[model samples]
Target: MATLFVITLIATAIGSISGLVSGGYDGLFLGASTGLVAGVAAWAVALMVAQWRRERRLNRYFSQDGPVAQHVRQNQRS
Candidate 1:
């Protein structure tokens, strides 16, 4: 989390600086804001992707014969 914050700050600084040089005052502010928003958005997206991957892995493993499945099956018979 600390690393992410540092990286985000560094990226924001670079974006803002580049914006100031390439564009104008408005660009600097907007670029910094945009960098922060984009960084958080990307993190959110990555989290969702990781969660989906974990769910997929779980589903795949569950589809195989295992103790959990066996227990479930045994319960269903009772």
Candidate 2:
């Protein structure tokens, strides 16, 4: 959230400054780098693992498919 925004800002500033000082568009290019993509890849891996765990648990307990599994509990009972 806020941390990500700050990180992106820092990347953009550093890239821009270094690029302007030495090369050109290096700032913008670096700013848009895929370095953060590695982090995203890790997060994706973790999320996939968590999803698998959840699916295993659901299969064991519910023995049900989707839609039904996603069936949220009723909050307002008649």
Candidate 3:
């Protein structure tokens, strides 16, 4: 998935940078493992946040005070 790829890229970049700063390939491997965990965590959080926002928007759209509800009320009056 695109989400996974983006997260992995970012994680890899951070891991590689940290690894290079600390030493050689050993650091790189450690950083990479850390990055993988971080990326998956980030992706999960992102998914949760997105779903929450979408549900909220849908609820609002159908609520009595929402635009669609107001439009229906106005049409009924006419």
Best by lDDT: 3
lDDT of 3 by residue, 1-78 (tens): 596769777997899789878978889888888887888888888888989999999999999999999999999999
Q: What would the per-residue lDDT of candidate 2 be over residues 1-78, giving only the tens digit for each residue?
A: 455555655655665665566656665566445434544555566668979998988777664454444453332332
Superposed model 1: Cα runs more than 4 Å off: 1-7, 71-78
Q: Give all TM-scores, in the order shown.
A: 0.65, 0.41, 0.66
The lDDT, on a scale of 0 to 1, for candidate 2 is: 0.58
lDDT of 1: 0.79
Order of models, best TM-score first: 3, 1, 2
List runs of model 3 lying over 4 Å from the truth.
1-4, 64-78
Residue pairs of candidate 3 with colliding backbone atoms: none
Best to worst by lDDT, what's the order? Answer: 3, 1, 2
| lDDT per residue (tens digit) for residues 1-78 in model 1 | 566566678778877887888789999998888777777776677678979999988887787486678889999999
lDDT of 2 at 21: 64
Q: Name the lDDT value of residue 2 in candidate 3.
A: 97
